[model samples]
Target chain A: MSSRIDTKTKILDAAEKLFAERGFSETSLRLITSKAEVNLASVNYHFGSKRELIRAVLARYLDLFMPAASNAIAELQQQHPHASLTDIFSALVSPLLTLNSIRAGGTRTFLQLLGRGYIESQGHLRWFITSHYGEHLQSFVTAVQASVPTIPRADIFWRLHFTLGTVVFTMASADALIDIAAADFDEKNNIETVIRKVIPYIASGVAVSA
Target chain B: MSSRIDTKTKILDAAEKLFAERGFSETSLRLITSKAEVNLASVNYHFGSKRELIRAVLARYLDLFMPAASNAIAELQQQHPHASLTDIFSALVSPLLTLNSIRAGGTRTFLQLLGRGYIESQGHLRWFITSHYGEHLQSFVTAVQASVPTIPRADIFWRLHFTLGTVVFTMASADALIDIAAADFDEKNNIETVIRKVIPYIASGVAVSA
Candidate 1:
C-alpha cells in the first residue's frame, strides 16, 4: 500500500484498539500518535480532528458491516418471507462473524468501540450512525416490526434500543464475562458463543408482549 | 450532619454526579474536590483512595437497594410460590424507585454509576459487588432459578448478565432514548416507565426456552 494509506491505516488501527480498550474521551491523541508511530500532524492532516478520527475508525467497520448486515437481512426475508424474529436476528450472525476476517478480533473490537461511543459520546456517535446508516437500520427495524406485528410501533422503538444495550454492553464486557463463566461454570466461550448466547435473550425480549 | 459527616457526604455527592456523567477514569480527584468544595485531604481522610471513593459512591446505593430488592423477592415468593420470572423481576421496581426518596434523580444516577462502574472499571467493580454482596445476589439468583426451573444454572448465569447489560445500558442512556421516543412517537416517559417496560422484556428473555 502507499505510504499515505499506510499512515491512515496505522492510525485507525491504534485508535480503534485504544478506543475499544480504554474509551473515546479517555484515549488521547498523543497516546494514539505514539502507538501509531505517526506525528500529530499526520492525524490532523488525514482526519482533520479527533472527532473525525473517531468517526473514521468506526466507519471502517460500519461501512463493511452495515451493508453486509442489510444484505443478510434481505436474503433471509427472500428465503423465508415469514421469518421469525429469532431468524431475522440470527441472519446477521454470519455478517458479524465475517468481521473477524477483516482484522483479528474485529467483531469484539468493533462492538466495544460502539459501546464506548454510545456510553461516552453522549449522543454524537448515535446521531452519526443513525444519519449515515438510517436506511440499513430502518430496513432491519422494519423486518423486526413485521415479525412481531402485535407489538406497537412505539414499543418496538424502545425494545430495539433495549436490544442495542444488551448486545453492546455484553460485547464490551465479553472478555470479563467469559473469564467468570470459565472459572465459575467451567464453560468455555468466544465471540461467536457470546453472540449466539445473546441472540435468544434479546429476540425473546423484543418479541415479548407488552 | 456533623462537619466531618458533611464533608464526606459532600465529596460523595459531587463524586457520584461526575462519575456518572463523565466516567470513572475520566473524572479526577481534583475535579471532584473542586466540585464538592472540599479539600483533597478530606477526600483521602474519608475514602483513603479513588478506588474506595468509587466503591463508596456505588455502595451507598447498593447498601440500600440490595437488601430491599432481596426482601421484595422474598415477599413475592412468599405470596406466590410459583410467581413467574416477570413477577420476580418486576418486584425490583419498588426498591429501585425508593432510591428517588434518598436523593434527587437517585435512581438514574445509581444505575448510571453502575453502568460506568462495570464498563469503566473493568472487573474491579464487578469483583467488589459479587464479593461484598454475594448473599443478596445468590438469593435473587435462586429466586430466578426457582421461577424458571427448566433453564440450566449455567444458562441462567449468562442470561442474568445479558439482562444486566440491557438494563445498565438502557438506564445509562435513558435520557437520550426518552427524548427520541417523545420526538418520534409523542410518548412521554419517566424512569419508572422505562423500568416497567424493561421488566417484561427481560423476564420473558430469562424464562424463554433455550
Candidate 2:
C-alpha cells in the first residue's frame, strides 16, 4: 500500500508541474488532484487548500535547496577560511547548480516554480521568505559580506540582490535562451563551469579598486 | 481638442501602468480604457487589440532603448577602435542604464512593463519579442560577441543571457530593494551609480582571462 507521505508527495509533484507550466493564478485545484492521480478529497486532506499546497510545492524545493546551500557554504568556510572573494562567491553559487543537476524529474519544474515566485509580482514568495527563509537570507548575506570585505554593506546588499536575479533568470530561461541562440551553444552542467563563469564577473563588480 | 495621437499616447500610458502592476493576463482592456480616461472605442480604434496595445507600450521603451544602445556602441567603436572587452561591455550596457534613468513618468512605467515582459513566464513577451525585436536581439548579440573574444562563443552567450536577466531584475525590483535597504543606503538618483555598480560586474563576468 502507498504511504500517506507518498500521496502527499505525489500531490506536490503534480502541483509543481502544473504551477510551473500554467502559473499559480491559472492553475486549479482540480487539475492538481487529477494529475496526482488522487481523489479530490485527498488534496483537501493533505494540504487543506490550493494556496497551502502551492506553499508545500515551494517548500519542497526550498527544503532541498536551502540546506544544501548552507552546508556547501559551511564546508567551504571550514576548508578555506582564507579563501578569496571569488572562492567564496563560487561556494555560494555552486551548490544551487549541483542541486539542480542531480535532482530527478521534478527538479526543473521546481526551478521554474521558484523562478515564478521570484518574478511573479503577486508577493506570495516574499511572504514565504520573510516567514521561513529570513535566517537563510541573513546567513547568505553575512557570508557574502565576510568574503568580500572591500564592498560596503549597502553595495553588498545591492550586488546580492542583483546576483539572485541573475541566477534565477539564468536557470528559468535556459531553454528559451538556447532556442534564441539557435542551439549553437551548450552550457556544461557542472558547478566549476558556473563558478568559472559567474564568480569572476560578480567578484570584479564587487572588488574595491587598488 | 486632443489630437488622435494624444489619445493613442494616453492609451499606451494606461496600458503600460496596468500591465506593469497586474501583468498581462490579469489586466483587462476595460481597466486600461478606464485608467486612460478614454472611451472603449479609443482602445480598439487606436491599437486594434489589447495585445497590440501592450506591444505599442513596449515599443515606445524599446524604440528609445535600441537607438541609444546602438549609437553608444557605434561611438565607442569609432573612438577607441582598440577598446578592451570591458570598454565595449560598458558601451553596450551604459546606454540602457542612461535611457532607463533619464526617462520620467510614462517611460518609467514603460520600463516596468518591459521588465515584466522579460521576466514573466507567461510567454506573452516571447511572442512580442519574436515579432518585434528579433533583429535587434541579433544585433545586440553580435555586439556582445565582438566585445568579448576570449570567452568561448557559447560562454559569452550564456553570460550575456545572465546579464540581461540581472539587468531586467534590477530595474524591476529596485523599489523593493530600496525599501528593504532603506535604513543604511542613500538612494541616489544618479544613473552613473547604476552603471558603475552593474557594468564592472557584468564586464568582469565576460572578461577574457589574461
Candidate 3:
C-alpha cells in the first residue's frame, strides 16, 4: 500500500512536470509513464485516464497547499484573534511563499498547472478545483470578513480572486519575469524576493478602502 | 488587397474565438476556416499554417491593445505631468475596463487568449509578445517609475508584474470566477463589476508604500 501511494505520487509529479512543459493537450500518458518510470497499467490503475490523471495531478496540489495554507491561516486567526487585514493576508500568503522556497520545483509546476487550468477551464479539472478547494477559499473569505467587517462579502471574494491571480500568475511567470528583471534592472530577483515583494501589494489590495 | 485583408481578419477572429473556447491544441484549421466562412486555401494563403494563424490571431490583439493602452498612459503622463500612482494606474486600467464594456464578447475572448498565450508560452507566440510588446510594457514601467520615483525600478517591475498577473488571471477566469463569486456571495456580479472592483485593488497595490 505504501509503495502504491509512492508510485502514485511519483506519477503525479511526472505528470505535473510534463503538463507544465508540454501542456494538457500535448502531454501524453506514455510520456508521463515513461517519465515516472511506471508502467501504462500502473498509470491506468491509479488514474483511469489522462483527464483523471490531470485531475489527480491538480488535486495533489490542493491536497498539499490548501490544508497547509488553511492551517497556517487558522493558527494566525487564533493567535491574534483580532488580526488586522495585513495579518490575515500575511497568514494566507506567507505559507505559500514558504512552500515555494522549500518545494521550489514542485511549486513551479503547480503554479504552471494552475495558470493553465484556470485559463483552459477544461471542464473536469475546472469542476475538480471549484468543488475541492471551494471550502478552503470560503474559510479564508470568512477570516477576511472578520478582519475587515466593513467590506462587502462579494468584494472580499473579488479581492481574493485578485490575490490568487497575482500569486498564480507570478508563480507561472516566475522564471521569465525574474530573467527580465535581472536583464532590465540588473537586480537579482528570485522566487523568495518575488514572494516578499508581492505580499505588500496584495495585502494593500486586500486592505483597500471601499 | 482590401478584400484579402478582410478575409484574413475574418479567419483570425474565428480562430481567436475557437481557440479561446477549445484551446490551441484542440482547435484545428478546419474548425477555424469553417467558422470564418473561408476555404483552407484562403487560410494557407493568408497565414501559411495553423501555428502562424495562431500567431496572427494573437498579434492582432497586441496591434490593437498596445497602442491604445500605451497611448492612454502616455497622454496621462503628459497631462498630469507628475501624476499620482493611482492616476497612472487608473490610466492603464480604465481603458481596458472601458474596452471590456464596449466590446463585451470580443474582449472576453481576447482576454482568454491573452492569458492562455502568456501561460502556455508557446514558443513563437511568446517571442512575439516579449519582443513586440516589451517596449509597451517598458514605457508603462517608466511611467510607473516616474509616478513613484521613490520605488526601485526592480520593485516597480515586480509590482507591475503582479498587477498584470492579477489582471490576466481574472480576465482568463472571467466566467468561472464570476460564477464562483455569485454562488459564494449570492450577488450577481458581472464583468464590468469585476473590472470596477479589481482596478482599485490593483491601483492600491501600485500605490503601496515603498
| Each model's lDDT | 0.89, 0.69, 0.76
lDDT (Cα, 0-100) at B168 in candidate 1? 89
Worst 10 residues of 1 chain B by lDDT: B1-10
DockQ for the candidate 3 complex? 0.67
Q: Candidate 3: lDDT of A207?
A: 78
Q: Write the per-residue lDDT of candidate 3 for residues B50-158, one digit (tens) a residue.
A: 7778778877766777878889998997789898767776675555555554355656677778776666653456577768889887788788788787777677778
Local accuracy of candidate 2 as per-residue lDDT tens digits, A12-86 = 877877787777767888888887778989888988887778788888778777877777777877898766767
Using lDDT, give the best candidate's number.
Answer: 1
Candidate numbers sorted by DockQ from highest down: 1, 3, 2
Q: Indicate which candidate wins on DockQ.
A: 1
TM-score of each: 0.92, 0.83, 0.86
What digit string (tens of lDDT, one per residue) describes model 2 on residues B1-210? Answer: 344558888888778777877777678888888887889988889889876777787888777777777677778878976676667667755555555564554434555676666766366776777576677677666667776655677777667777877777776665566566665676653334554576666666566352
Better of 2 and 3 by TM-score: 3
lDDT per residue for candidate 3 within A68-172, as digits (tens), equals 888887898889988887777667555555556545566667777876666555445667776888888767777888988888877877888799889877876
| Residue pairs that clash (backbone atoms under 3 angstroms), model 2 | A201-B205
Error of 2 at B97 (Å): 6.9
Kindly list the per-residue Cα lDDT of model 1 for residues A88-184, writing each as its tens digit.
9999999988999999999888888887676666678999999999999999999999899999999999999999989988887888889989999
Q: What number of backbone clashes does candidate 3 have, counting pairs of residues 3 or more apart or in separate chains? A: 0
Q: Is the docking of candidate 2 incorrect, acceptable, medium or high quality?
A: acceptable
